[model samples]
Target: MSLRETVNSVDTNAKRQACMELINEDYNKLGQYKMGEVQSRNIMIIGRTRTGKSTIKLLLMDPRNVPDEMTLKSGTKDPQFQTFHIQQQEVVLNIIDTPGLFERSNVESDIRPDEAILKGIQLCANMEITKFHAICFCVALTSGINAQDVEAIEKLIAFLGDEIMNNSCLVITHCESKDEEQRNRLKLELEQDTFFKKINPFFKLGVYFSGSLNSDDYKHGNESLKNQYLTISDYRKKLLDLFIKIEKPFPISEMIISQIRQANDSVEQKTVQLEDEKQKNDELQSRIKELQEKYLKEKCLADDLRVKYEQQERLVTDSRVTHGQREGQLKNLQEKLQQKDNIIKRREKCQAQLGNDLKKIIEMEEHQTKKLEDNFYGRLRSVYDADKIRAVFLIPVRRIITDYLRYVITSFTVVK
Candidate 1:
């Protein structure tokens, strides 16, 4: 066989040996109860971390191994098994002490609390030791059962099934320090606790207060210490007797195992889904950031364009104002030109009237000259009859005609 196969074989053998040990322990302890036949009474002890689960197991099954002082750290990291035999009655008690439920570990290699619990139950079930005579749910009395304890109890029930409580009982530890009145008050408080009341129906054997003293305290202590130790021992015996009195054992069926397997698969699927959703959210955020940057760039561009447009508008308005001033100057110049054209038209009209008046005066002067010439000609004819008289009249008439013609010529020139 190969090395891998050999290792696997060894592992299988070891597991079988462990199971056999559990079985043999039960058979040896309860042989007489079955009328000379071998039988085992299996009991499962469960509780939260540091609730004295392992300590309770040691004190009950092997008192000699009980520690002198309680350790602050957890004792059981995995499932453990022990068997106790009552010498007189020839009875066996097979006990499986499991790691605490809901235990937090800083170590990365440590198994999860729920996984550890399932592993412990599976281990016991593999031995065909499915039936449990008693399922002792341990709690520290000093802690006084809080919400975490209640949640742990609920988780245990979910794993093992509700019927496990049929043979289950509450085991309150650290009761040795409490006085009678204090113990009574604590019990009353437990009775009022919501979880306790809820599970009260299945707890036929009810709750048990378990306490233990170290060997040193028992042997060398004072009277009161010894009495307390004896009382604690008696409580342990009563717990054992309760296990013996159970008529039926709580069975761990295949259905419960199948349910646990399904639950594990569901948890894995949910983890994968959560990772996918987170990735999608990250991508969406990145896209949103990109869009916001683009929007800002566009807004800046728009603002620049608006400023340029306003500048251009101002330039156009100034041009329009200058054009209006030029138009007013042109209109004034046109009005002056129109006034000069009217004056020129009036001067031309006056010059034409003066020319007409000068032509009439010239015509009058010509008429007067003609009439005077006619009168002189007639006198010359009369004087011609007498030669001397005719000569004198000719001289005077010629002088007057000359003077008057010259005057008419000067007046016409001046008028032109």
Candidate 2:
């Protein structure tokens, strides 16, 4: 085989081995890894307050209705982490059901949302987990995303970086009733959201109604719980379907050629991006050279304008100084002329005033005028007798009260 063929063959064999190895880990590990064995994916179910993180965990770990003793003993039913091997695929899943973060009452000063997500990431990283494989951000189907949910999800995306999101899943839990319409609406909303829009392209995303597959009244064999069990089973199958897809080898190979094609496509995309960047850099260099030439021309023009402006300014300043001296001399002459004119006017004004004083004496005699209407009785009442005025005011009030009493008596007969 050619070297390229040999490498492709090796990759195919390695991928097959990885698939087998993952299946083995799921069966033999009993959900607990051997001291040094690695896992395929450690799924951390995270969300804001009461959004079914625990429900997702329970469904994943105990889909057969089997309880994990160690996790049960942990006594944190709401917040838990458990390792389990999924059937068939032998995918060893380390699942964490984190509690409602960003609650005012439940928030711990030390245990922040960042810490929770980072701890999950660290555990996966320590286990030498290359890919998250699947991170189901559990959101309640009944409610839309809140601020805290946004904050926690934002932090998680940042913590896991872009790779995790590419391989992530969105698990909507506690979906209301048999209404797929509501679930569909929620899914539409999530897709439209900016964060999910960015994440959706990378990850396999879908919406699920929890009670649809499992009736709320599920009884193991009992008819009451049977419906509920069926509903649960339905949801379980959905979960299985989701994780199975995630646990499958990245860039899956149901057929040999598809895997090769996906690989080729990835390479081609990278190559195109690289070529585009190179083109952008060359364009930027050309633009920069053009700008530099234009800048030099502008600088030369600016220098010439500055020299011309400075020479003109000097000429203006000289002219302004000479004009100012002439203006000052003219102002001095005008001031002397104005002073003489003022003295002459002052003498004329004084002579006119002496004549005006005598005319005022005659006008004052002619200007005397008066009105002569008389009110003879007005002077008598400035201080009237206080008793008289008081009686004048009290008379009408007394009459009104007397008339009111007479009217009330006439209007209503005595209690009969």
Candidate 3:
């Protein structure tokens, strides 16, 4: 039988198997995922020493509560890194229940929870486990935002960077049988406090009434250490929203940079092509002009030769009535006229070919230039920058929410 099924059963081996299965399930569900693959969220529970960090983790992972078998408890009191998977919606959350921030009691001091908290932070930062999507900062609701709590949270924030805290949240636990009104009042009091206000803007806070989870005294009812398991679904929803906020900001900046580089490269290639087309156009125009000039010169020479031939023929006709010497001059003028006509005809053919070539060059250059303009302008407006920044910042906000909820509950109930 699975660990979850056997948790309430009498068999000890079944219980141990349940624990092992819970650990495995937790590991499988958490971390980045591919398409069609379910991705898991890593939620690190952090708080001061003696603040029910382990208790809360135990309750959350207990087979009586969470019906999962793959929950693995790893790490030490110095630097804990426990993994557990909780199926919520489309994704599974891999919760990393960390050690308390400081050593609160000599009894708990043997475990060295503070070091464990730091190590958990380091692990998340290094991407040793996927960066914690959300952090649970357990705080005492009665004490509100205390100096030690503040200091521990600040150290965590400093280590994780502003991004992680923005997504992390506070949890006010152990609300001593008081109803919602008392919890709300406590929340407001904390919010109004100077220290709370400073960190309030960055984190999301939540409240939970957790008396205890030790179910051994089943007949005693209220006297039983584990009586109620508060849902706090409202905060849970908000926490989910925080996740959306944290994850929404995709790396658009990197995408924009890459797009810009591609556009620049395209522009460079087009500019080179444009230059070549322009050069070719200039050459074609010059060639056409030269051909036209040659054709005009040949036509002028042909006209002069024709005129001279006509004048010589007239002289010969007059000379025929008087002298035979004009005949020879007429024949020479006729020969010159014929040669000039042939040269004019050849020049006209060359000019026609040059005109057609020039037209083609002009059309080709126009087509190329138009294409270059479209390509350059298309990339100019393709990129979006604001969306990318939002994606990066949103992840931090979700983490803040998780931290806030965990802090409130753990603080109120867990006694030092």
Candidate 4:
């Protein structure tokens, strides 16, 4: 196959996914003659309080510290650690022991197991620890039916999720139970529980009693509990068995002074990325708020302008109405002025006719008077010489008539 086609045929995520799956997969002994340096693995030992976990922890330490049974507390109170090398197996181990599930109270000092587990994981992530091979639970066979056990199991499951739960192992401590039937029944029930349902059966590290280092065995009577404990030889073998059955070790460093370290750089980087995106989202929200404010301001201004424009329009309409009325009034007034002009012209014509009538009357009156005067004068001149005395009296009368005629002529002239 061509190189590119060959690469495409194999899924890289699936290949890396293989890193997630291991059930009795061999953990090769690596040293000067093998792949690299002495390889190490991280293991978690979990269970309820006072389940002989301290005894187990002592046994697992490189130089075992014998825990005084009388001095040992009921609950571990905090997560503990150990570093040891199984020289025969050519492997190193870092085991973690937590105060068993549901042991925490409302007390401030005792944190919830799940929260402690998260804190522990975050610690590992901060230190750049990678890969948790197996999380081994150390349960007490004597008290396997505790109600709190279920919650503890659920918390552990939640802490790791189902994927990593598949790599888990449950080691039944206090294995020397007096009633074999009860132990068997309890084991069966535990196996059927959801905590064990998702896990690989082979990783169930066989029962071993985590007894006190300096105390009497009350279960088996006042003697020591050596038989209940795992000897160094058996411990090494079983631990190696768990390592082989669990997931692969991280490719980097080994023998941490503490707990299981998973590949969490992806999670951390994603957290930072999420924070950055959130910051940007907040900034964008602020900007949107600013824009909305600006838009509201502009809208208010536009509304005011619209109101003013409407007012101006109303004024213009009123002015137009008034102008129409004034125009009509002006037109009516012009019509009235034209009518008055016609009446004045009629009056002037009447005055002119009256003056012509007066002139005709005066001329007719003068004609009449002149005719009368001429007729009288003619009579006098015709009769004057015939009788002297009559004629002498007639002469004065004639003179008087002449004078009156002259005066009448002058008066007529003045009247004309």
Provide C-alpha RMSD values for all models, in order. 17.4, 34.0, 54.9, 22.3
Query: Global lDDT for candidate 2?
Result: 0.59
Please give the lDDT score at residue 340 for candidate 3. 82
lDDT of 3 by residue, 81-124 (tens): 55554454456555666665555445644334334554564445
lDDT of all predictions, in order shown?
Answer: 0.73, 0.59, 0.57, 0.59
Off by over 4 Å in 3: 1-36, 62-76, 104-117, 125-127, 204-219, 223-227, 230-416
Clashes of 4: 5
Candidate 2 displacement at residue 45 in angstroms: 1.3
All candidates: TM-score: 0.51, 0.41, 0.40, 0.42
Better of 3 and 4 by TM-score: 4
What is residue 340's positional error in candidate 1, in angstroms?
78
Task: Report the number of the highest-TM-score candidate.
Answer: 1
Clashes by residue pair, model 1:
29-91, 29-92, 30-92
Encode model 4's per-residue lDDT on 1-89: one tens digit a residue. 99997787687767766875542243443224434366677776776677766666665653134455444346576666667776766
Ranking by TM-score: 1, 4, 2, 3
lDDT of 1 at 245: 76
What CA RMSD would candidate 1 show?
Answer: 17.4
Instruction: Look at candidate 1 and tell me the lDDT of residue 93.
Output: 80
